[model samples]
Every structure is written in structure tokens, then in C-alpha cells.
Target: MVRRLSIWAVGLVIAACAQAPAVPPQASAQETPIAEYGFGVLADLAGTRWRGEPGEADKEHGQPADYSEWDWDLGGSVLVNRHVLEDGSYGGVTYVQLSRKPGVLDYVYITSANFRTSGTMTLNADGSWTAEEDVKGLPHILKVRSTGRRHADGTMSGVSEFLGDDGEWTPGHSFTYSQTTAPLPDLVPSGSPPE
Candidate 1:
């Protein structure tokens, strides 16, 4: 499966390049997102800190990753997620997003300490993002599918669902992750300019 995904990703890059327009002498920060091996739009998540607050969970049926801290690195394209239940031990995922058609639809590819998975996330008409994960692994007891919607207060709420072998889904614990940093303007160099 990984092999097939790799080949498909390569093909996507080639197709996007063939369809991409010429870059002007200078491109602004608002320039069209570029998909170089699927790392373009994912760049937006950089330099952000997410603090995930736990909600309610079923101790018997639901298995939620209790995240107390999540820090996304701008330089490394990595997210270090600290688990609340298991202190000192944590998991990290390197986020990668590839545009299948440059500006049409992009897919998310995440690589973590143990596994790599791919999926899609679409922005809803209501200004929220609904993300779907390709694989959610915990094995037999329950096969979970990840789905989440972004909230307006820079908070993302997500829950796991158990996809029945017969194609049904049961929702699990829902949690919210909020951005820790308030949006601040860039620092003025020194004797720059008077606003």
C-alpha cells in the first residue's frame, strides 16, 4: 500500500508541475500554493501551538489519545504530541499535504514514529474543516476512523468513530484543540518605518 501511495504521489507531483504556471520575478506571501512533493499547504500549520483539552470518553469502549500538549515546529514540519495518560512518553507526526491538482483538492500524508497514513480534509462552506483519515489503527477491539471539524475560535474538535465491518460508524470521545498563541504582528527590525 505504501508503495502504491508513493507512486501515486510522484505522479501527482509530475501532473501538478505540468499544470503549474510560471512564477513571476517575485512571489508574495499570498502567492498560489505550490505542491512540491506535497508540503505546500501543510506549511500553514507551522509555528502553531495546540493545547488539546480532553472531553468525555468511554473507558470501556473508547480509546482516546489523551493529548496534553502539541507543538508544531515550523522548521522541522513536525508535531510533538505529549500524552496526558502516559507521562514522559509521546508521539510525533510529520505532516505533509499534497495538491493533486495544484489548487483543486489536497490530501494529507502524515508520518509518525510508528506508522504513515494518508487522508483528505475539506473546508466546509460554513468555514469549518472536516478531516477524514485513511487509517486509524488500534487493532481488533475497534477499528477507528478519524474525523474532525475545525471550530471558529481557532479550536479543532475531533472524535474517533468505530466503523463496523458492515459499514456503520459509532462516534467516540470528542475533544477540542485550541491554538495557544494569539496572532501577533511581526517584530519591527530596528529603525524601520513609522506606521
Candidate 2:
């Protein structure tokens, strides 16, 4: 029975691998030209949250935890910047800052983390764009990909992925945002201003 089960598992794994997406060929390093663009940052203030199975082995062994009851109140902002390449494709870096609000959960306190993600953003003539980022960190790495339409009002809507620590890339999160009309404040210089 055990031998049969192992065969079944192996068959399932092969079937799943056949369903993965094919990677596109990269542009030649020497042929690709680098282009850059400056973009203003915007915040999506509707409030974000994340919930998942607890990491504790004891908790999982004792009883099944209700994941629906576990969640954290968090907020995040995305700084979008883009550059065009000689291959006619575009790429850019998006700096994302995420913070969890205090006293939002009963059992856990979420700490603040920032991710500086750099990826390729391809703009299609059809008013649609796709952005992909490969994020590397200690213990694990993630590949996040997003596809959205650029509205006439300068807003964007799309779905995202939160590839987990196992190195397997999969679609996991979704989000939407509109451009803000308020003017952004100027940045302070490194040196202190004259008092």
C-alpha cells in the first residue's frame, strides 16, 4: 500500500509541473537599452490584512486552528517607477513599505517590514501593463507578478502573488488602487535645515 501511495504522489507532482507557465526569453544584454521614468508615490489607505495558519507545531498538533479567526490589520504603500529598455520592453523598481497597526490582534503583534522590489514592467499598446518582481531575502525568496489596466484617470487595478517561503511561485494576493489628487510633500535634504 505504501509503494502504491508513493507512485500516486509522484504522478501528481509531475502533472502539476506540466501546468506551470513558460518563461519568456530574455532580451540580449548588449542590445537592451535602459530607460527611466519618475513617478509619484501613492498610498492605498483602505487597510490591508493577512491571515494564515499558525507556525507553531504544538498548536497544529493539539487541535485544528480556525484560520478565519486569525488576521492582522496592516497598511502598505507602493512607490512605482519605470524605465524602458532598448528591446522595447520596460522595467522598474517598486519600493513597498508595510506596517501592522498595534492592538489590532489578540495573539500576535505584527512587525514592520520593508521590501525594495525591482522587476520588469511591460507596457502594452492596449492600455494594459504587467509587472513582475523576484524578491530575495534570508530563509526564502518570492516572485510577485501583477497585471492591470491603466485607466484614463491615471489609476491601475490588478492582482498580485505572494509566493511563499517554499520557493514555489503561485498567485496569492490581490489589490486595487486609484491615483490621488493631493500634492505630495517635498523630501527633506540629508543635512539639517538652518534653524
Candidate 3:
């Protein structure tokens, strides 16, 4: 009698469970967002904007300061960077994508000055990144190498060197950038687009 009663109770519970309404599982509120591009090496750069004034060397040469905006686009598949100089002298857009090889990124830069560069960038072990690029439209500059690192104080610093015709790597530009809320100004604003 005891066994029969236990089985009957189990059957009732099973029937009740079977008759209950089904509920889809809900996502956890505490769940973290997955970093896109798998490696997430450049995650910190997304949704950030920066401003860098020309260095003393550049100031002495009348180079204008520049502003940069970085963001993830194309459903987080590509990292886009747009920059413009203060005096409207130059501006460019850069697209960064994951290369065929893991842990490497390929970038293409096109500027208003009709210069273009294609490069591969790698993240260093010390939390810095380095880029090696081939420059087009500049006869004197054959290649460009650059490195950037973010500081703890929320600023960034980078140095670029140009490979000249003489095969010497000369200093190109050095920048110390601070985070900014400003947008990149138009390089050549002519008005609204034709409808």
C-alpha cells in the first residue's frame, strides 16, 4: 500500500508538470557582452574620441592639431577611425579589420591629401600596438611604422616613423592625445548632399 501511494503521488506530480505552461529561458541581466572580432584586442578603442595637439616639432613647422573619432561599425565587424586637422588641412578615414591570421589586424587609410596606406597592426605584449604600412601617393615616403599605447591617466601617446627613399627611418609625427567629447570636423564642408 505504501509503494502504491508513493507511485501515485509521483504520477500526479508528473502530470501536473506536463500540464504546466512552458516558459522560455530568459537571458541573465548580469551576462556580459561578448567582445566582437573574437579577440577583443581593440575593444577599448571603440566608442572613443581623442584630440591630439601637434608636438613642438610640428608646431614649429606650422602643423595643425588633429581630432580623431573611433568606433565599431558594420555590426561590430569593422573598426572605423575618422580624423581631421584643426586648420582643415588634412583628414582621413581608416578601416581596421581582423586579418586572415589570428591576432593581427589589417588597416587601410585614405586621406584628403590623396595619400593612402595599407598596413597590418599587431598588439604588443606590453599593451601597446604597432603598425607597419606601405604608403602610396608619397614619393619620398615608402613605408611608415607607428606605435601607440594608452596611459593609465586615460591619455594616449604614439610615435610614427617614415621610411624615406634613403632607407632611413626618420621621425614622422608624435602625438599625446586626451579623450574628448568633440566630433571630428568636416575636412571640406560644401553643404548638404543633393537629394
Candidate 4:
């Protein structure tokens, strides 16, 4: 009888150890979706003035120049606060911001043009996000459709495209915003945020 009781006790211990712990249903209910984050860069193509190639400058002097034929490159990332939306979706707006510093080429010349921007991100239930910003009297908008998953270490990667008013498509600008926990320092002044 003593041996039988000992075996029963061991079996009970094993069974208890094998059973999964009870996870509260509400815990899952309150869980937020995986968040996303990233950075971006933008070039003011409209402000670009193309002085023809070095030798061609002399050939095209004093002529009505064409500023419309210039190249601009814009890129950036977003740091999403929450990965999912409130409606059981995969994303939502959290406490995160997008920032940009001017490129080397943008600063070399003494042009009155300034390169700066600031904006917020909103993740949609359908795995999409919209980034909106107003900078230097121009409005910038980006719409992203997530095409990837969040990793175990809390990182997500996805592609995004830029949209413009007047229903026209801008060329040569695309981005991939990644989510990270790394802290970013404030580059702007005390009362204002950097663009």
C-alpha cells in the first residue's frame, strides 16, 4: 500500500507539470498588435535647379532654364507604437514620430531652401498605415501596406509608397519602415520638434 501511494503521488505530480498553465482570456483581449517603426529621407525635387553638365553650361547660358527636369530622392522610416489596431487588427497609432536631417548635398550650396519635416503615423486594421506631414509649405503623404510579420524580438519590416495630390504619381521614391525600441535623441529645440 505504501509503494502504491508513492507511485500515485508521483503520477499526480507529473500530470500537473505536464498541464499548461491557465492563460486569462482577458489577457489576450487586451493585447495590442505587433508595433512597427522606421525612418525616412525626402528630397525637394521641385526646388532642384539643374545647371547643365559642366561643359554644357557654356552651351546653354542665359536661356530660360527648365527646373522641372530635376531628380529627387526621399526615404524614411516609422517607429510604430503598437503592432495591431484596436479592432483586433495588426496595427494602430501609438506615441511615435518621424524625423529627417538634410542630406550632405542639400546643404553644400547656399540656397534658401530648407530640408525638414515632422509627422505622425496611423496603423490600420487591415495592416496598412498612413503617414502625413506638412513641411516648408508643402504637404507630404505616405500610405503603407504591410507585407511582413513581427519578429519575436519586436521588429517588423514592410514597404511603403508615397502619394501626391492632383492624382498624379511621383517617380523614384520608395521606402521600408522598420520597428525598433532604440531611443532617439531630440534634435530640435525645447519647445519644438525636429522634422
Candidate 5:
């Protein structure tokens, strides 16, 4: 009687297995469609505040050193970047998301300077990202482009240029950022620069 019960249980298990649907091997988390499309390319930047001293051009332009922090929002569907000068003189917040086009990202930057930019960022084969933006509310510039690269030593650097009246690209912002724990200046809300 025990052998018959064991056979019955085995038959039930076989029936259940035969009825189960076949599922192909699933991709790993990193190989998911969103990740493969480069949605999380900047994920490593989250979780740390970075500091960068003002470049010579920044000093010439009266800009101060800055701190930047990045984080994932909306369950990792968006990347948010916040930056503030060490002196509390300037700051900006940026929101980035995967563009409709694969391997590209769309971003909007709102500055404390009463200007904002809409841009697209793309990753280069060399592990760098380039951003091209159209400026608004700032009469002196029309468009801007920048490239940022992360170094093996965990430092980040970027070079930017602005479109000039001559249709030429002139030097713009530059910075080399490293992880920081120092206090950062306050960033007044976007569209509401301090008096």
C-alpha cells in the first residue's frame, strides 16, 4: 500500500511538471532591457557628494568651488543631480532620464542664475558622456556642450564650451570632482534665486 501511494505521488508530480509552461532563461539584472539601454550608466555616481575646486576659467568668471550630489528617484527611473557652490553663490539641479532613443539621455537643468537648459547626454565608447544643451534666459549664450569622464582613480572631470556670437565654441565650465564629505552651500529653489 505504501509503494502504491509513493507511485501515485510521483505520477502527480510528473503531471504537474508536464503542465507547467516553459520559460526561457531570464537575463541578469544588469542585462535587463533598461540597463542594456544605458539607463543606469550613471548609477555609480549616486550615494556620494563630490567636490571640485574652481578651474582658472571659473575663477576668472567669479565662480566658486562646488559640490555635487546625485541620486536615483522614482524607483531608479530618473537620475537627479544637485550642485551648489562652496560659497553659496550659485547652484543648479539637473534631472536625467533615458531618452526615447536608445543610448541617449534627456536632461533639464535649472540654475540659481535664473536660466535653464534642455539637453541630451550620450555615452561615448571611451566611457565618457557628452552633453549638448540649448540655453534659455541667458542672453550671452545660445548653446553649450560638455564632456565628462570618470577616471580610474574615481575622479570625475569635465570640459565645456559655449556657442559664441561668431558661431564659434568658446571655453566654458570645467571641473575635476572627487568624493567629499564637506558641507555644501545652500541651493535656493529653482526659478527662485535669492534676493
Candidate 6:
């Protein structure tokens, strides 16, 4: 009986694998360029909040506790990132703005994290972005850098690293952002009042 059950389990596993598709559903639709690149790309990104899921490295760091949500608000010409970790114990907010500069081919991003660390980056042709900046008040001069990319899954993902005065980049933690659900609109009776 045990041998027979094992054979059945093997068959089930094979069937499941065969049923899986090559690409995830909606990949082609979402990843395709919806509009010309540049500041225009921010249109679909604006008025929306993307939430991040902590990776294994982040979890191992004893962070990203519940009640700590990573949300990036891309509205107006600026991007506001709010994070609450350990129920508001230790978390910092960041503000990032993207624009054009003289002789710059890509949109330059200026970021201020908790008013401490300041950085700049640009969107790359590969649909990825990177930033580099310094933290004002630390034990030592600290330079931080991060790289992230957006995917058709409607998520922006990245990792961050700390550059100590020694100029060594400590392995950083992973971060990502996914769209937050929009609220339903309120209804009002119109045309003719219901009886």
C-alpha cells in the first residue's frame, strides 16, 4: 500500500509541473511599454502606492516586522516613501524627486531619507534605477547606494548597501514595492430618485 501511494504522489507532481505555463499570466501585457519613456513613465506611477515585501536577507536582519509597511507614494513631481517597522519602533521615511539636468540623458533623482541621508540617481534604459548619497549625521561619513527595477508584475524591487568611510559596501537589504488597492467611489442617486 505504501509503494502504491508513493507512485500516485509522483504522478501528481509530474502532472502539476506539466500544467504550469512558461510565463506568468499578464506578463506580456504589463511589461510592454505603455507609453514613451522619460518623465511620462511617471504618469502610470503617480497617484499610486507600491508596497514592498522583505526578502530573506531582510528577515534575517530582524526587521520588517508586522505593522511595518513599506509604501512608496509617487505623486506630483516627488516620490514619498513611508516605512513603519516593529510597529513604529525603528523606521525612516524618504522623499525622492526625479527630473532632467543639464547634459544628462536620464532623469536625475534626488532623495532625502529622514532628512539625514541625501542621494541622487537616474532611470536606466534597462528599466532599472540607482542612487548614491551620503548620510549627514553618523558616527562616520556614510555613503549609501541602492539599485532597483520595475517589473510587469507591477512591483518595483531593489536592494540597498551602506558605504562606510572605509569605502566598503556592506551587503544591503532587499526591498520591493507593489501597488496598493484603490478605494471604491461613493455613489449618489441621480437622474430620478428611486421610489
Q: Which residue pairs in candidate 6 collide?
A: 51-178, 52-176, 68-84
Estimated TM-score for each candidate? 0.48, 0.34, 0.74, 0.24, 0.74, 0.56
Error (Å) of candidate 2 at residue 101 is: 41
Clashes per model (N, Cα, C within 3 A): 0, 1, 0, 26, 0, 3
Candidates 3 and 4, the one with greater lDDT:
3
- CA RMSD of all predictions: 14.9, 19.7, 23.1, 25.9, 20.5, 17.9
Candidate 4 lDDT tens digits, 1-195? 110111111111111112122334444412421132222111122122111111132123321111111122232221222111111211112222332321101111111122232343332223333344323322442221112222334322222233445454333112112222233221222222111
Error of 5 at 154 (Å): 1.5
lDDT of 1 by residue, 1-195 (tens): 111112112212211222222334465424433332343333344444454544554333332323333335555544332222212122333233334544334444432223333544433223233344454332221233444555445566655554445666665455565555433222222221111
**Stretches of model 1 off by over 4 angstroms after superposition:** 1-43, 58-90, 102-115, 136-138, 141-147, 181-195
Off by over 4 Å in 6: 1-38, 65-77, 98-115, 182-195
lDDT of 6 at 78: 49
Positional deviation of residue 92's Cα in model 3 after best superposition, in angstroms: 0.4
Q: Which 10 successive residues of model 3 have the least lDDT summed? A: 1-10
Q: What is the Cα-based TM-score of model 4?
A: 0.24
Give Cα-based local distance difference scores for all models.
0.36, 0.27, 0.56, 0.22, 0.57, 0.38
- The count of backbone overlaps in candidate 4 is 26
**Candidate 1 clashes between residue pairs 3 or more apart in a chain or in different chains:** none
Per-residue lDDT over 7-89 for candidate 5, one digit per residue giving the tens place of the 0 to 100 score: 11111111111111122257432332223365544666666677776567666756566677777898988877777766665
Superposition TM-score, candidate 5 onto the true structure? 0.74
For model 4, state the Cα shift of residue 167 in Å.
5.1
Q: Which should have the higher TM-score, number 1 or number 5?
A: 5
Q: Give the top-scoring candidate (lDDT).
A: 5
